[model samples]
Structures are given as C-alpha cells and as structure tokens.
Target: MVIHGREPDWSYVARSVVKVLTVTAALLLTLTVGERALEVFVDVGDRTAQVYGTAARIANPDKRLSHGYTHSGRLPVTTFTMRGEPRRAGPSDGTTEYKIVEGLFGTVQAPLLDGPSGSLADAIDSVEAKPGDGRARATLDGLPPTLVGVGVVEFAHKMTTEQLVAFGRRHKICGGDDVAYIYEPSFYDDSSDPSSLNAIVWNRDMTREDDWAEFAYQCETEPERALAEFRRWVGLLDENDDLEEFELAYGSLKGAADEGVTYGLVFDRWKLADLRKLLDDPDVGTIHLADVAFDLDTWTG
Candidate 1:
C-alpha cells in the first residue's frame, strides 16, 4: 500500500505548481507597469499646466496693471543642489558643490511703462536738457550724437505735440518730455521711512546753488507733505500703509556703475498683483517705474 502512493500522478503535481507561479508573476508585472505609466502621466500634466497658466496670466491686461502696495508674505521654498568635478588636466583642484533655495511668493512682476519709449532715464534727460525757450533743440544738442542722429528727441517732441493735440490741443501741458515716473518698493526704516513720503529730485537744469536751495526749501517748507503730492510732482513715493517699518528697502545705481544699493520690503502677494494692474491701464499714459527687483534670489545674490 505505501509503494502505490509514491507512483501516483507526479506530472500533474508539477504542472499545477508551474501554473500557480506563472499567474502570480504576471499579476505583479502588470501592477508595476501600471504604476509607472500613471506616475509619468501625472508629471507631464502638472508641468504643462504650470507653464501655460503663468504665460496666460502675464499676457492678460487686466492682471498686469500696477497697483501701489507693499508685498508682505512668505513663500514655499525649493532647494536645489549642483555638483561638479574638475578635469584631470585642469589647473583647478577639486569638486564644486553648491545649493540654491528659492522662495516662490517672493517674486513679483510689476509693469513699468506702456511702451518701450517710456524709459525713466530718457524722460529725465529730456527734462533736464530742454531749453527755457520751449524748444527741444538744446536738449538735442546735449544728447549723444547717436541718439540725436536717430531723432529720439525729435520723435519725443512730435509724440508729445500729438498727444497734446488729441487732449484738446489747448489747455494741454506740453513739457512732459522731461518728466519721469518711478515706483520703488522697500523696507521702511526711521531714517528713510516710507511713512514720511517725500520726493527726491535731481534737477540737472538747476544750477548747483539752485538745486541745493530747492532741496532745502522742500525739506523745510514741505517737510511733512503727503505722498500724493510727491507722486504728482516728482512721480515717486513710498506711500503704501500695508507695508511695515522693517519690510521695505531700496537703492539705485549711480550712473552706469554695476553696483547698486538694495532695500527689503515685507512680501505681499495681493499687492504685487495690484502693481501689474496699474501698468496695464491705458489711461495712465507713459508712466515708468525703475529698479524693480522681483527675483529675491537675484537681488540677494
């Protein structure tokens, strides 16, 4: 009876074991393939949405107008690591490693002007060089030959006259070629307090004595004037109330020097959107804002 048990159906037992193993292996392979495909699809969809969404937002005029407000918010941080090794024959020695951390909401895009011609420097130069005779001929003489040859001042004059003609030709202000508008955001300090809204004008046409005299006059006579006045006359002010004392900073480069001063401001996402809105307004005319730094990393770097 024991010998009969050992000889029965050995082939059937082998086939059953093989079938079970094949089924289990096929199921595991299918799951693995499905998971990989899902991961790829999700990644692609997310990237496409981010790129397209940002591009669309920037292009929309309603979203791009400038609003005067200080940004005060925190953003999510992303870290990146880079590693590099020098060539064997190179004079430099070792591997280079670096890390970069970026904040998302710290970046803001503000509109400067409606068109490329609304450059702040050009506006200032035009105002400073224009003769009292009400002709831009003197301004043209002071400009570089290249600029004069290209008829930048002539074009500016023509454009100014045309704008005046459209704005009822009579009772229209004519000398706007010399005026420049600038918007700067910075952390407020007691020394250079944002609350004490004031305009800093460098009247190149004014003699040094006159310029100093005018500065003194403004410092004393209108020492504590509102930012609105400053904005209207000189075209700039640190006037937003949402900004706190330590949240804003600013500085400017002297001439064409590479180095410039920088200031910090509290980050605000909503205010940044408002700034874009101001720039997009058609009635604002040729407004210009300069020294805007949206990329915190670049500014800090």
Candidate 2:
C-alpha cells in the first residue's frame, strides 16, 4: 500500500520484530534469575538466624536463654534474651555494636572482660565473685540456707575424671550425703597457662548420681564427643577474632581431654553452708557464688 517507499522494506521490518522479541525474552530471563537469587539469599539468612540461637545458647550455657534475629536498616541484628534481659548485637556503620540496655540513664553496657592467664589466684579473680560470706553465710542477711544457689568450685589441681566424680560423690551437697547436681564441668589444664579451656555443659535437670556417673563414663570413654562439642561452641566465639581466651580454653581442653576436667564444676543448687564445707576439702580450690533462687521450689535447670 505504500507505493512511495521502496517496496515497504519487508526484511528490515522482520529484523526489527526479531530484535524486539529477542530483547523481551532476555529481559524476562534476567528478571527470573534475579528473583530466584534474592530468594536463595533470604533463605540462607533465615537458616543462619535459627542456628545462631543454638550456637549462642551453647556458647553462653550459663547465661543465654534464647535468641532471635532482626534487621536494622540494611544490617542484621541478633537479639539474645538472657535472665529477663534483652541484648542485641550487630554491625553498625562499620563498627560492631552491642545494645545491652537503654534507659533514662543512657545505655548501660557490660562489655566482655579480657580473659586472663597467670597464677591460679589471678585466674580465679577473672570471674567476678559474688558477695557472700567467704565461709558459711549467704550473700544477703535474710537469705536462708534452704535457698539454692548455683556455685562454681574450681579445683586446686588436675584430677582424673574418676577422681573428680568421686570427689563430687564424697562432698555431695545437703549434709554431704545426698547426690550432687553438677550441671557442667570446666576442663582446665595448668599446662595451658594464661588461658583455661571452656566449660562443657551437660544436659541439665537430671538430678541423679547415676546420670553423673554416666557422664563421667562418657568423658572417660568418649573423649572425642566431648572435644567435638567443645569445639562446636568455641568455633562460634565473638566474630571480632578475639580468640585468645577461646584458644586457651580449647588448648586446656585438648591438653587434658584424656586426663579429666580439672578447672571445676558448676553445682546447680547448693546451700551456702554446703558450698563452704567444700572449701575445707584439701582437693577443693576456690568457690565462686553465682545465681541465687529464693523459692525452695524453684527448679534450677
């Protein structure tokens, strides 16, 4: 119908149509790939968050109760709820930040202490010792002996796992005859001077001598499992490469993994008087008083 234009240039029109079709197909393919990539990235992040809570709980076995993940602008924030306190950690403006507390008094932050390596006395002081009568009294004046307090009792020297278990059995809490509720064991070796190995938290709430004996058996027969569990949590230490403490912890563990956990034991519920009696034992080192649950019925697991 266009008699003036050289036969309507049919080839040019066909080439133009082909070029448009090719471009449209390429765009659709690119968009599909981009969407899938985005989904994969999000999925990975979600899984990481879930496992992070597990890792955090393991790393701070004595403290952290639970954890979750949220976002601040484009950065990710990990929130951990410990003993009714909420703490958030994340990267902010190229610097790591820990949101411990915010109130009218400004942010109150309790930074992690530097791990110490030195004499036993120096290492003992590294952990903040709660205020209590060094011998038999509770930290508070009105506190009763029935109120169970969690305490950490470090050993004076490395003991065989058998010896350690025997010690717990012998110096059992509650008149020195009842079964002791040992929650975890700190594997420390004096050979690994400067830093001690981390503690290995066992499954809690099983209050029986048989259960403890079984754990001792595992420590003696299956050292590999204990070491693996220790490494799993130690591997997830603060991402800032502040690994000297953890390294020392691991070294102490590995150095004496075969011998026994020499550092101490985390006794779940002990009367202050009972814990004090432990101080009299020649094998016992120092005791650090920790959480105090007032209600006798309160189950500390």
The top-ranked prediction according to TM-score is 2
- The residue ranges of model 2 lying beyond 4 angstroms of the native Cα positions read 1-62, 67-143, 171-228, 231-260, 291-293, 296-301
Candidate 2 clash pair list:
117-194, 197-249
Cα deviation in Å at residue 103, candidate 1? Answer: 4.4
For each candidate, the alpha-carbon lDDT, in order, equals 0.26, 0.40
The sequence of per-residue lDDT tens digits that candidate 1 reaches over residues 53-172 is: 222221211112111112222423333232333211112345444322322322222232111222323332233234324233333343332210111111122222223234222322
**Tens digits of lDDT, candidate 2, 1-301:** 6667556888999999999999999999888766644533454234333333333333333432323343323322223222212111111123223222211111122233122122322323333233323432234234565565554566656555456656756764221211221223434557756434444332221112122354333322232333344444445433332223222333433344334354455455566556666777877656655555553344444
The TM-score between candidate 2 and the true structure equals 0.40
Tell me the deviation in Å of residue 62 in model 2.
Answer: 5.5
* Worst ten in a row by lDDT for model 1: 260-269
